[model samples]
Target chain A: MENTIITIASGKGGTGKTTVASCLAMSARQTVQFLDCDVEEPNAHIFLKPRLTREEAVSLDIPHVDHNKCSFCGRCAEICMFNALAVLADEVLTFPELCHSCGGCWTLCPEKAITTNRREIGLIKSGSAENIHFTQGELQVGTATSPPIIKAMKKTIQKNSLVIIDAPPGTSCPVVETMEGSDFVLLVTEPTAMGLNDLAIALQVVRVLDIPCGVIINRGTDVYSKVETFCRENNLPVLMKIAVDRAIAEAYAMGIPAVEAKPELREDFRKVLNHIKGVTAGERTCCH
Target chain B: MKELVVISGKGGTGKTSIVASFASLLTNKVMVDCDVDAANLHLLLSPKIEERHQFYSLPKAMINREKCNGCGLCEDTCRFEAIKESTVNPLGCEGCAVCSRICPENAIEMVDTVAGEWFKSNTTYGPLVHARLGAAQENSGKLVTMVRSQAAKTAKKLGYDYIITDGPPGIGCPVIASIGGASLSLIITEPSLSGIHDLERTIDLLEFFGVPAMVCVNRWDICPENTEHIKEICRKRKIPFAGKIAYDNMVMLAASRGKSVVEMNSRIIDEIIKVWEKVFEVLCPNMKL
Candidate 1:
């Protein structure tokens, strides 16, 4: 059987996506593969505390204008929508930070003067902890883009093992890129107005991507009814609800995974995993 | 005009809640919501759209399948792997025009997609400018720039002295776009480990841009020790540490009712008022709080 790729995402940040991803991966039945796609501010590495055995710099190709072979035709600058390249009479100036690394200039240069050079934007670290294989990406502090690093991290996905991805927050490009190829998406959200509001947007995103998804309510309370109402009306399964536990909060503050500190909660995560497997299996059967 | 942007490195850390509260306390300001990805400020402000504009930032590649040659050359040449058997994955395509330029049959063309829309709306607080990016659309940074530029223009036209912006979370392109050239930024953070880690990254990003910032810890009671640690870091960096707001369930009720914490009678609101006073002192050194 192929390993299922489950991505834990939330439209709102700090809603326990990392907490859920780490705990679920730790509590899984088999050897779990964990990929932290929240490159912008990845926190799974903090909780997992994997002894990183390997590291690689994530680089992108930026156009380097060769003055010797250059006609300075200005075609590269004309095609660049990001204004990353500017054509001068003698030289073509490049802004690597603004470059999307789409390889447009290198391929479209009629003079063939456009060569490419690699610029390191981020780093990927991989290792293992207990029965889990951990891989995470960290975007350089000053870098403005995160999707490319996320893509690089996703490339390390192992299809033969059950993979749990902690996606970046929000419903934008980075989140979209993280959730792209996953078998199922688990949305972790709180029961606040902002949580419910952002969850709706996140739900819409998953629907557009055509991925089956379930919900996990973190810090569950009776204060807000909208999240529950929205889930029921949408027919989305409420997989698990972890109540507001002060001990859990303290453990999280100390960079501890709740399932590790309180072993009993592993049962809760196991149940959630079982539910996800059941739902994913049902979808497969229906499709076949 | 001075601009104060509220940003959190981690999401759902009460950035919107704090900004909504600030909007209530502050007057003669233009409110701008730059979190175009999952915009929630509109839900709180209840703005009435006075003018709306479509935001078309990124160009998407389209394949003219009729130009007829299944060469698969474009797929091989594409770095993003956006093209698959004549179909283009709009999300993956960065619209670099490499496929259109290299296509032997001239079957591909780049067209501007309606990435999102921005609006100038009337709210009780002031004129509000906000935007919503289409789901899975790229160019969030571009849309954020558009929203800020429009907000600046509207602020000038209306003779407003300040621009209060609700910035997006994460230290990425959109977050950069929100804080660029802003007079001041108020970072709303929590006291968790992830919160502290992300806060450091966000502060580093802000310092890299040479933007002066103030810090406020929301739900500080959740982890008082971490909250104190955050204050120590701020003090070491010479960044002003605004007062902390204790956790309160009233914030949840206020959000559900589309109201700011300041509107509700809560001790958290009082702490936010003090934070606003501190921010106002930094934003307008000559003005009285």
Candidate 2:
């Protein structure tokens, strides 16, 4: 079987993106690579508990100056689009938080005094839990950008396994960066108006990116059928529905995956994985 | 004007639900949705845009093919790898201006792209200033700052007493830009483990900014024990505990109907009211009940 990348994302946070990702990866029969790209607030690690085998510090190159070799020409500061550097009257100051690490400042410095240094913005941890290869990134607090760290994490993807990505919530740069290269996207959502609204926005993103996508309605109940109706109307398949179960909620609060909390649900999650495979395979045939 | 922001460390924890209820309950206020990426406040508020403006602050690299010397210097220097020969992928460009500076032929330029649009709208509540960031675009922090400043300006212009903002989730740049310097922030969280984990980080973030923060555990009934844990943590940290709200299907029904809990008849509405009262008391001490 060819390798497939499935990303679980939600327009709204806390709508079970990480939960679904963890359970799905755990229940899949094939070797799985689970990448938690929500660097800002990664939660899958709490559930996966993969043994850490490697930890890599991700850093961005920021400009440093040699005061003695420098004429305090403000040209470097003027060319910096992110406002990361400013040449003050008496000193040159750099705000590492604002730096995008574009390398424009030191490269353009006429005095040849500016050099670049790698400043840690985040770190990626990789290890394995049985059949599942686990990896996640943690962005340092106060770091503005997450795509670079997300990109770094994606570099460790092994092509031989079924890769499941737990994307950051919201349909923005970080989510887009995570979903870009995926073979399929599973948008997790609740049935609330906010969920439906955000789901539509997320659907637009995937559609624009031309990736085949489906919906997984978490916390399912008959009381809120708006999400289901919207998915049906849009012709997007609803692959799975995890009913709102109190036991599952308790297990989640205790940081346990539903498959473990309710052992019967392992069968349910396996069925969901099979359904995803069938759908993704069908789409590939259609494209060819 | 006193600005109060509603945020959650994790998403879907009822941040918007609380903000929507606050809008229905408060008078003389301006609403701002700082969650520009997946903006849903407009769906509930039904804001009719009175004015709209294009937001063009995020810069993208533009290579002038005519002036290109076919030299790969720009590509070699671009740390973001946005430049490939003469083509620049706008999504990959971080707007570093390194390519423009290193281009020997001066073919590269940093140009502002229309990243998003902001609107001044009239809702039943009051003036609402919100924006929609372009899908797959960077710089949500900039759009958030724009909406917040507009909210402040609208509040000052209309002589409103408050600016209530719905902040995005996580302690990222957008969240930082939203809660900084606010009169107070209401951190809405769930009773899940991730909620507590993220809540701690968000509290630390607010502390770093020295912004006074209050906590409200939404859907507290989902896990009563965890809810208790959350309250205990709040007490230990000396953070004021606003209240806990029980999970009610009616909140979902109200959201489906484009209404706040307070706008409907539900028991959760009473709990939200108490939460609001505590929030206002802490945030607006000078105002009378």
Candidate 3:
């Protein structure tokens, strides 16, 4: 079997993206590599319960000024697009939190007074839980950036194993970083006004990334047919519909995957996996 | 004027719903939606746009291929991997302008790209401020700051007593931008493990920024034990536990009809009213409800 990556995402938070991603990993027959790319508030670790085997700190290069060699030229501050640096009459001030570490200031400094230093922003933890190999990024509290941490975490992707990514909510830079190189994207959303609104925005993002995608209507009910109509009109595939079941909610509150609470749901998850496999297989032959 | 921001570290915990309810109940206030990437408050409030402004956050590097020799210096200088074969991928670029600065042939120029749009609208409740970020755009924190400052100016000019903001989810840049210098923040959470985990982190963030905070569990009945745990944590932290709302289907029903839960004739409305009173008392100590 070819290596495949499936990312579960939603524009709105708390739409069960983590639930679906973890359950799919638990039900997969292969050894799945589960990457929780929601660095800001990762919740998959609570359900996966992976015994972490390794920990690594993720850092970014921030500019540090060597004032002794510096003339108050203010060139470094002028080249910084993020406004991370400011030139004063006597000193240069740097705000590391605002810096994107683009290396523009250090590279452009004529006086050679600027150098880069590492600032730790987050951590990457990797472990295993049964057939699932889990890895998640933990962003430091009060840190303004998350895409760099997410990019660091994605470097651990295994080549031979099936990969499942639980993406952060919102269609922004961090969410785009998570879904960039995936083979299939499963968007989880509920059937509500806000849900439909956010789902449309998230679908637009997937379209911009040009990734093949499908929708999973969580907490599904017939009362809200707008999501169904939207998907139909957009020619998007509705892969699965998970009803609003109290038992599943209870299980979720207890840190149990929906498949574990109701064993029959494992087969449903397996079928979703199979369907993705079928779709990707055809795409590989026709496009790749 | 006081600003009360409604946020959830984890998404889908009824932050926007609760804010909409506050809008329906409170007078003399401006409502701001800081979730620029996925603004949902407008769905419930039905804002009629009175003013629209283009939001330009950071400039993107545009190559003037006509002036270029095909040197790869720009590609090598870019840390974002946005340039390939002398073509720039706007989605990959962070708009830092490093590539344009390092181009030996002077082929690259930084151009201001409109990242999103902010709107000033009139809703049934009052004035509302919201924004929509372009697909795959960065600098949401900047856009959030723009909407909030606009709301503050509106509130001050109109003599509004409060600014009720619906904040974005997660404890990231956008969330940080929403709660800074606010009078108080109400964190709407659920009684799930994920919710508790995120709540603790969010409380820590608020504390780090010295922002007074309160917690309210939206579906507290889903897990009574966890709700109690959350209450105990709040007590230990000396943060106010506003109140708990029961699991009610009317919340969803009202949302389906683009109405706030407070507009519906459900017992949940009373509970939400109690939560509002608690938050209001904190925001305005000398006022009578």
Candidate 4:
């Protein structure tokens, strides 16, 4: 059996992404690797509540000052590209937050006083609930970048069963980092003009990345035909639609999956999953 | 003197529409669109670029072929795989300068590259600060800070007293950068499954940073029960719960025409102006207006 990696992404936010992702993760609980890559505001954990068994720190290599071997030359400070490293008449300041861990100062210093140290930006955590093996990352507060922590989270799914990545919202770098290399990308969207424009941006990103993608129009409405028409004209498949149901909202606020709160949602989500399986299987059959 | 950042943990949740309304209501307020990755506020504000400044995020490594040594050390030392064989992949190279450090031949040098541009421009309304980034660059949060700071400086200089901004959605770098030194954050959100979920996260982010924030529900009528749930959440968190905006078409009509909702003379604009009044009250408690 091939390990099919699936990514659920919606460029526009607040469009039932967490609701659908959580439902799919719960129903397909047996022997599935659920990786939540929305490290910025990872809400999947609120529902899953997995117990952590493994914890690892994510750090970057930044330069450390050794004043003893240093001349007050200030060359390292002057050469730093990101302004992460600074120098003064009596002191040198290295703001690790500004540093991308480039280690430029360490190499440029003739005195070799510059050494490198690891600074923790975030952490990777892994645990499980029932048949679901879950991992989610949290970028440290005030930290500017999320991709490094996301990279660590993705690494946990290596050689794992049925990996499903719940991507972060937006068509930015973090979203690309999560959706890249997935076997199928499920682009979730709603029925609004802003939703349509943002979906267009997400489509461009996925197409530019050369990933085959399809759409799942959540909160289905007659107005959402705009989305359907866009998908049709672009030759993008419309996989499934979860209607505008208030029960889904209540179920989520109560911290339970929609399928668990309302069994009917199971039928809808199962159809979504089956459609994905059919398409991926057809692709695999062709490859073989 | 005062800054208002419109942020929602969930993107496409009516942040720009709200910010545009606030901008139209408050003349002389310096406007900034901190949603750098995919900025859409300029579409409504219709900003005409007057000055442009390039944003150089990080330097990348370039190996000199004239002083070439094909030693495998540079390749082996690079953790980012920025140096592949003889060619340098600019995207992969994090400008770590590790290869330059490890190379005994000293053939590698790092140079600054422009990641994006920040623009200060004139609009029909007033001054605007916005930016556009190159694909896969990693300085979005920094760019947000730079824009906010510049906007604040401009506001302070002009005695504008208000720096109204539309922050990037989510609680990542861009949002955090938007939150710094702000008097208040006006979180515009919906009452959907993801809206409340993302609000919990965005509120926590603001609280962690010790910034006072309030919530405003867009499309309150679509899910009235969920809107009350949001109100209850605010009650529990001890944060002030602001008013709600009913689902309105006038807002869309204004945006479709590239105009601010406050600029419209329709029924929706009146309700939105009420929301703007609250924003002004929070930002300027002492103002008689």
Candidate 5:
């Protein structure tokens, strides 16, 4: 079988994205490469418990101006889209946190005074947990951008390995960055009104990206059928339904993967993986 | 006016649900939902859109094929790898305008694109401010800042006493933009290991900004030990600990009905009311409830 990249994302937070991703990794028969792309508030590390053997600082280049060489033309500040640069009568100010590292300021500088300086925005940590190869990104607190760190983490994807990505909540840039190149996306949601609402929005993102996707209803119950109705109307497959189990919630509170807490769950997760493989395989054949 | 932002470092810790309940309890406030990415507050509030404004953030690069010489300078100079064969992929482009500046044929134009939309609406509870960012759009922090400033303006002009904001999850740009300069922040956390871990990081962010913060553990009975651990950490850090809310399925039922827990008849309603009272007391020490 070829390598498959599966991303678990939810439009709302705390809907069990990490839970599903980690459990899926543990249940996979072969070695798995797990990337926790939720840099801002990465919780997969707590669940995966990978013995981090490597750490690398992810930095972006921000413009560093040399006053003696600068003509104070203010061209760099004027052209900056992020407002990271500002020019005063005698000095120029650069806000490194606000810089997007687009190389606009220095490249456009006529006086050649603006040079690049490395600003560490986050760190990428990699290690292994048993058969699972784990990597996660930690965005520096108060840093405005997470995409740079997420981009750095994606660089470590090993070829021809089962890759599972735990994406951040919400349908924003960070989520988009994680789901961009994935083979299949598993959207986890609950059967509640808010869950149905956000799930619809997240589906919009998947549609825009044109990726094959499915849904898993966590804390599943018949009390709220809207989520199921929405999924049926959209023709998205319901891969798995993990009912509202108190033991699972308790296990989660103790930093335990649901599959580990109840070994029977491993079979359920494995079945979900098979379904995904079949879906992706069908797509590849049709394209050819 | 004092602004009280309810934030949870972890998503699904009941921030929006609690805020919806507070909307029913609080009389003189304009509620603002700062979660522009996938906003859920509007679902519960049932807001009637009163004012709508297009939010323009970073400018995206647009190529004029007629003016292009096909020199491929724009593609080579682009750092984001956004340009390929003189065509810019909107998803990959960071909207930095470097291609426009470096284009030899002057074909690229930095065009202002609407990233999202913000709205001022009237709800049964009171006035509400919210926004919806376009799918796969960037600069959510900018859109969040816009929603907040609009809320503040509406609050001040209408003589509202408070700006009750429902903040986005995480300690990122959007969260920072929502809580900065706020009078107080209420960090809602669940009684899980992930919840506590995220809560500590959120507190560090609030401390970094000098924003006064309080802690409220939702579904505290889910794990009593972890809940106590969270309270101990709050005590050590000198942060006020708001009341704990018991785990209840009724909250979900109420949400499905588009109602706050306070509006529904359940034991959880009183607990939520108590939590709101504690937050209100800290927000307005001198004013009467």
Candidate 6:
């Protein structure tokens, strides 16, 4: 049971990435797993309305310093790669937010004052609605790192389930972690010059991962040719285009994916699914 | 100095476009493009980069080929799976140093990798601080913070009143980095489904941070009906509907010529001038623009 993993990502936001991902989950034949890695501001749940069945803390292994155990020594501070731990003659300080939790500091502590502790960086919640199994992550406000929690969500995927991973915006580590191991990546972008340049960067990220990617031009009617020309030279497929329509906006305000709010989007969603199957299913058969 | 940050919860909703237009309307103002990830404000502002500095991200563990030993321990201890075979990838490595420590053969070394470039530039209007993130680099939030901090120092040193920041799109770290200690934020959005949804979330984020904000609806005519819907949403939230920029081809034409639409002096330019005035009035509630 080789499941098809399709990641809906656009280097730029407000391009209907979530709208497309939630719709694809609804259009799937069997169990579709939806993972929202946009922990910063997740809106897929607002559209899908999934009743979260499980809520668990996503923690990191940070070093907790014990004040009573030892004399303040600078050895642990010198060895920390992240500079999370610092020691003075009188007191030791640990900035938990900066800690990457490599456990190096705790092991290297000369006085053995450093002990492992858990810091809740984010939360991962799982639930189901319709034919979709929904799981999403929420990065705690002010927390710097999010890729680790994204990795945790990626591990929750089951076999034979059509997975739609909604990645966060920007061409960074969080986006990379979500797009990893995906069969097909949908790079959503608008038609503006800014959109084209950002999409180019996003495309390169997927290319480095050695994954076949397709571009879906959001707001296509405004500037389709610029997007088409960029994709043409790069050999990236333009699976579908969603034009700028006001009806789609109204549905979004009331909290629903456009495809569910409008039947017209259903046709576009189907075309994208067909293109995904054609690309990913072919790769799966060849591997088998 | 009133700080007007152009921010949107989601990207590609004309934050830079509106900022460029606002910059064009004003003179003798220092503009900071705080959207460090894919900063294109310089593209429209046509700023000549005067000076550049290298931004270094987290260092990556590298296998010293000369230190020769094909040990499997480095690969097994790597938490990021960055160590595959004997080669270590800079992009995937998390800078944990687990590979360097676990290498029994002492063949691994961690090296600082240049992540991106930040620039101090002079635009036709005034000084501009911008950045370009390196290909496949993380730490965009840090780069954005650097730009704003530099811009603030420059504005104060140069004796400029207003330091306008074109913030990054989305409600995440980069945007948070932009919104810090700002006098006011002007969120540019459209009358659409994702626009309203993201706009409300953006409003919440800004309010949560206690940044007083006003809304400027871009391309409202494209969805005239939703324009009213957007207006109602703003009214319910008590967010001042600053004004609307009707959809116009001149925006793209001006951008193609490396100019802000506000410099074009079109009917749209006049409307944007009105929006800026409203922003000034609300942000300065006591003063008349």
Report the number of the highest-lDDT candidate.
3
What does candidate 6's lDDT look like per residue over A1-288, in tens digits?
A: 678899998876666788889887877667788999988777788888899999999998888888898687687777777788788888888999778777777766777888888899889999989788999998776666888889899989998778899998888778888888999899888777677778888887887787888888875664337778888888787888887666665567556677776777777787788778887867422111
- Runs in model 5 lying further than 4 Å from the true structure: A283-288
User: What C-alpha lDDT, on a 0 to 100 scale, does residue A99 get in candidate 1?
Assistant: 91
Clashes of each: 1, 1, 1, 0, 1, 2
The C-alpha RMSD of each candidate to the native structure, in angstroms, is 1.7, 2.1, 1.5, 4.2, 1.6, 3.6
Q: Write the per-residue lDDT of candidate 2 for residues B1-289, one digit (tens) a residue.
A: 7999999878888898889888988899999999999898998899999999998855778988899989898888878777776799887777777777778899988897888899999999889999998777778999999999999999999899899999999888799899889999999998988899999988888888899999999989888889999999999999999998998878877887888778788888888989999999998787775
Residue B204 in model 2: lDDT: 84
Give the range where candidate 3 chain B is weakest over 10 consecutive residues by summed lDDT: B98-107
In model 5, what is the error at residue A105, expressed in angstroms?
1.2
**What lDDT does each candidate get?**
0.88, 0.87, 0.92, 0.77, 0.91, 0.80
Tell me the DockQ of each model, to 2 decimals.
0.72, 0.69, 0.86, 0.29, 0.83, 0.31
Ranking of all candidate structures by their lDDT, best first: 3, 5, 1, 2, 6, 4
TM-score of chain A taken by itself, candidate 5: 0.97
Off by over 4 Å in 6: A222-224, A283-288, B65-81, B84-87, B101-105, B189-259, B263-271, B282-289
Q: Residue A242 CA error for candidate 3 (Å)? A: 0.3
The DockQ-based CAPRI class assigned to model 6 is acceptable
- For candidate 1, lDDT tens digit of each residue in B1-289? 9999999898888988888889988778999999999888888888999898898856778989889498998998888889999889998888777888888999998898998889999988888999988888888999999999999998899898999999998899999999999999999998988999999999999999999999999989989999999999999999999889998878877877777788789887778889899999999999996
Per-residue accuracy of model 6 over B157-194 as CA lDDT, tens digit each: 88887888998776766788789789999998877666
lDDT of 2: 0.87
TM-score-based ranking? 3, 5, 1, 2, 6, 4
Model 6: chain B TM-score vs. truth?
0.91
Question: Which residue pairs in candidate 3 have backbone atoms (N, alpha carbon, C) closer than 3 angstroms, thus clashing?
Answer: A13-B11
Comparing 2 and 5 on DockQ, the stronger one:
5
DockQ of 6: 0.31
TM-score for chain B of all predictions: 0.98, 0.97, 0.98, 0.93, 0.97, 0.91
Error of 5 at A92 (Å): 1.3
State the DockQ, from 0 to 1, for candidate 5: 0.83
Q: What tens digits encode model 5's per-residue C-alpha lDDT throughout B1-289? A: 8999999999999999999999988888999999999898998988999999999867788899999989998898888878999898888888889899898889999888888899999999999999999888888898998989998899889898899999999888899899889999999999999999999899999999999999999999999999999999999999999889999988878877777787788688888888888888899997777
Fnat of each prediction?
A: 0.74, 0.73, 0.82, 0.32, 0.82, 0.33
